[model samples]
Structures are given as structure tokens and as C-alpha cells.
Target: MTNEELEFNNDEEVLTLYDNEGNEVLYRKLLQFYHPEFKKEYLILAEESNFSDEDGDIELIPMISTDDEEGQLLPVETDEEWDMIEEIVNTQMDEPEE
Candidate 1:
């Protein structure tokens, strides 16, 4: 899909990838779903490609320029932060009667 056709749902932190036929192929959360290597490759592609519009807003592009090196760095959320998030999710899930 072309850069213009891509969209980012920042509220959900999801990257919605589309097929050549304009069908949704994948939905991945930026913080929760993607592998570190894939994220790195995405970053490299974004760095190398020239965007037609530069209006200071972020855009999602489905195509990856594969000539670039793959990125392999994982996110660095601390254990405490992860634990807190886990606790929050668990608490929400465990909530019972009103």
C-alpha cells in the first residue's frame, strides 16, 4: 500500500497494515505486539524514505525498503513498570459487581 493510504490509530497504538487489494491484512499494537526485529526494520525504513508531506504529523507506511538493515533493539520498559501494567490489567479484569 502507498504511504498516503496508510493510517495510524494513535489512541489504540495500532498499526493497521493493508494488502495490495486494500484489504486489512494485519493489526498490531506498537507497544504490545510487534517483535523487536520488526520494529527496528520499520524504524530504519522510516529514516531512509522521503515523505512527500512534512506537516509535522506522524504517518504509517506499509511498504518496507528491504535493502536497509533490520532493527533488533527491544523496548526498554522497566520490570517495575511492566509489573504495574500487569497489576492494572489484572485489577481491571478482576473487577466484580458494581
Candidate 2:
């Protein structure tokens, strides 16, 4: 994989992740917020068309970036953290853009 494919940029608004088996997956940025308790940055992403689920609902995946060349993606490890992130993303997504 090239360097470009391995990295994610907020300016680009889209992210591509490679699986362990070397398959390329894509996701679009839906929301980004900072966790007040953990003091970490997080992103909520909608899986791209090719990776979407059977019901056509855009699956949201929450991740934290390691900020390296590989752009390592890590999930919110704890239930509390996941709940907090989920609520924040949902609330933000429901608001209208001004």
C-alpha cells in the first residue's frame, strides 16, 4: 500500500483503512469530538458504500488515530468511553448546521 492510502487527513474528510488480510476499506467522516474525561480525540465515521451493511444503514465506527504514518485506528476500549462518544456524536449529528 502507498503512503497516501495508509494515512487519514481531516482536510480530506475521508479515511481508508487496510485490513489484516490486505483489503482496503473506506469510511467518511461524520463527526469529530474530544472526550472531556479521557482528554482524547475521537472520530465517528460512516462506512462507505462498498463497506455498508445489508440494511443500507450507514454503520458508524468510532476510532482514535495514533497519528503515525500507518494511521493506526483504535476503538474506544471502555464501555463508559464508548457511551460518552456515542452520545456526543449522536447529539452533534442531530443538530442543524448554521
Candidate 3:
């Protein structure tokens, strides 16, 4: 869905994706940014139901992006990709939100 078509609930954008078992799962799009090194766009998504960690803090999981036509969110593979994702995310977290 396009960004404009994204539905927001409680001030968060929600996207519905089906799991391996074909069950619908809801996730909140916490962040989206282009990875300069990888020349690809990535997203930080947290499952709605599992939004919080055991400590009741927001858990950001999965730095996902795929080149496939479907635009499916696939987990990034490789140390380099992971490192880049972490670095970008950390930088984002440190920046004061406007």
C-alpha cells in the first residue's frame, strides 16, 4: 500500500502481513529509511501484539527489504547489512524528534 493509504491507529502506521502459516499479523511501521550503502530502502517494524519487550519497552525487530516485485519485507542477511541497519537505527534514535 502507498504511504498515503496507510492507516494510523493510536498515532502509528499499521500494516497487515500474512505469516508463514497464512495467518494475518499486524505490525507497526516504526521507521523507514534508505540505506545508502545498500542502495535499498529498509523498514523497522514491530508486531502490534508483541510491540513491547518483556521489559515493556518498544522492541524494534527486523531490518527488512526485498528487491522482489511483491515488495515483501524480507530480513536482511549478512553482517554488513546488519551492521548498517544497526548504525542507521541508532543514529535515528539519538536524533531528537521534531
Highest-TM-score candidate: 3
TM-score per candidate, in order?
0.26, 0.73, 0.73
**Span of 10 residues, lowest total lDDT, candidate 1:** 40-49
List the pairs of residues colliding in candidate 2: none
Give me the overall lDDT of model 3: 0.71
Residues 1-98 of candidate 1 have per-residue lDDT tens digits of 22233232223333444456997544333222222323312211122122234774323322322333652233334565345334433443355635
Residues 1-98, model 2: lDDT tens digits? 22232222333277787778999888888766555457666777876864457776667888886667976778879998888766666666676766
Q: How do these models rank on lDDT, best leading?
A: 3, 2, 1
* Candidate 2: segments with Cα more than 4 A from true spot: 1-12, 50-56, 67-69
The TM-score that candidate 1 achieves is 0.26
lDDT of 2: 0.67
lDDT score for residue 22 of model 2: 94
Residue 10: error of model 1 in Å? 14
User: Which of candidates 2 and 3 is the stronger one according to lDDT?
Assistant: 3
Per residue, candidate 3 scores C-alpha lDDT tens digits across 1-98 of 22343322223588899989999999998878665546777788888998767887777875566778987887788898788667766766676867
Compared with the true structure, model 3 gives a TM-score of 0.73
